[model samples]
Target: MYPLDEAARAIVPNLRGAIDIPNCGHWTQQEHPELVNTALLEFLKGL
Candidate 1:
């Protein structure tokens, strides 16, 4: 659904981080709601 991660990072200068949810697709929250929510919570807590 998008460019390769490395290519995306190179194209978008402000890309800061990633949460790799293996085997998930473009709609991560819809595809893996629990995993996505957990990752989002962890990310927000760190900030």
Candidate 2:
């Protein structure tokens, strides 16, 4: 939350959607690779 709080605040034009992944901490791609991959696929498909 600390590292991402500032980034979260910048939500005017550039940023689109934000996903708060659970069951994982900072290292999301490393700690939860499968979950990250699945989420990425779904998001890409939407576009």
Candidate 3:
């Protein structure tokens, strides 16, 4: 999916802002919950 994502972005740069939450597959949030939380918090703070 990462490679496919890259190819899609290459063809359609406008979709680069998309956030692909690969929850089921190697779930980054579950694997690294603290990291994910920190990033989320920071993003919200920015907004």
lDDT of 1 by residue, 1-47 (tens): 34466787888987666667779889998999998889888888988
Cα lDDT of all candidates, in order? 0.79, 0.76, 0.68
What are the models' TM-scores?
Answer: 0.56, 0.56, 0.47
Model 2 accuracy (lDDT, Cα): 0.76
Error of 3 at 40 (Å): 0.1
lDDT (Cα, tens digit) per residue for candidate 3, span 1-47: 46577778888976534345554457788877886788788777877
Report clash pairs, candidate 3.
none
Best of the candidates, lDDT: 1
**How close to the true structure is residue 15 of candidate 3, measured as C-alpha lDDT?**
57
Model 1 — TM-score against the truth? Answer: 0.56
Q: Which stretches of candidate 2 lie over 4 Å from their true place?
A: 1-10, 13-16
Across 1-47, the per-residue lDDT of candidate 2 in tens digits comes to 34675667676555546677767789999998988899899888988
Clashes of each: 0, 0, 0
Sort order, TM-score high to low: 1, 2, 3
